[model samples]
Target: MKLGRHSPAPKRQKCDHWSPCPPGNFAYRILSGGGKERTATICFEDEQLVGEPGSGINIAIVNYKTGEFSSTNFFHMWAHDHSKQMMDFIRSAPKGTLLLMATQDDGSTRLKDYAKELVENLGSKEIKNIKFRSSWVFIAAKGFNLPDNIQREKINHSDQTKNRYKGWPAEIQIEGCIPRNLM
Candidate 1:
């Protein structure tokens, strides 16, 4: 019989990243909703800030300097007049705040043009392209800009012919290390 020593498993980094983040950096992960059973989630600094399955949008706010989360909210846009409210919530974020957003179901059904513009201002390039039940996730900074190299936004559209689940698209996720706010 051959005897071999067992090795310990590698430690998991924040947000289950492939590797540990560099010093003075924050780790984050954002996942868009898939089918009815899979919900969207947002994680930062090793904590799950938001996770819920429903129609509309999920939002989380985090303090950039302290690496602390402040709030989580959901806005139902499919059949509600909540676009203005959501826009206000986004505008309320203060400087140095990190905004994480994900869509659970139909995020663009009732989304207005102004709201899309606001998301665009936050560096989102795919907001205008979201369709019915499209899976989308985004991370944006309020006052500063995230490095261009960092992964900040991702989207997957629901196509009947190529849907991963019945009437829904496959889930999409973005995970990476964001440098700590130095300014």
Candidate 2:
């Protein structure tokens, strides 16, 4: 009986999640790169912390307790020897920090084994399998452990026979609600 423009349809959860997270949880979304148009993206608690197009690795650090981002940075792994620096950055994150990573283009050409090993310590099972132009995304907690049921990582490799783009693979994405009480 009362309405000019209907109250905008019930707002969707952050990052367009299909459903709202429970009261004590936060939502997040991670999208990997795919060609020139599809770049990488990272969303935490309904806020986009990183979404730039380039060729390398994108990283975001979040304070688990505060629910705020502490830093956002990327490395050019395709054309530069930034693996050492990337490793150093990862090592610096303290306990209770949430680390999110996504690939924009080629993330393994310049990535050394040391860097991959470091990521593995954080529970990434696919870091070693990444190949040229592979789309990858990962989330890990520095000190605490994420629930085993949560989706922690994903990857898509560029296959000449079935790539979505002429020279790039299709993008991959992962979204989930993380419990805020994670210690």
State model 2's lDDT: 0.90
lDDT of 1 by residue, 1-183 (tens): 869988889898889988999999999999988888899999999999887565688999999989999888888888876888888999988999999999997898889989999999999999999988889999999999899898889998846466668888888999899999554
The alpha-carbon RMSD values of the candidates against the true structure, listed in the order shown, are 1.5, 3.0
RMSD of 1: 1.5
Give the candidate number with the greatest lDDT: 2
On TM-score, the leading prediction is 1
Q: For candidate 2, what is the TM-score?
A: 0.92
- Evaluate model 1: give its TM-score: 0.94
Across residues 4-69, which tens digit of lDDT does each residue of candidate 2 receive?
A: 766668778787898898899889999988888988999999889989775688999999998999
Model 1 accuracy (lDDT, Cα): 0.88
Error of 2 at 165 (Å): 1.0
Q: Model 1 Cα displacement at 6 (Å)? A: 4.7
In candidate 1, stretches whose alpha carbon ends up further than 4 angstroms from where it belongs are 3-7
Error (Å) of candidate 2 at residue 151 is 0.4
lDDT of each: 0.88, 0.90
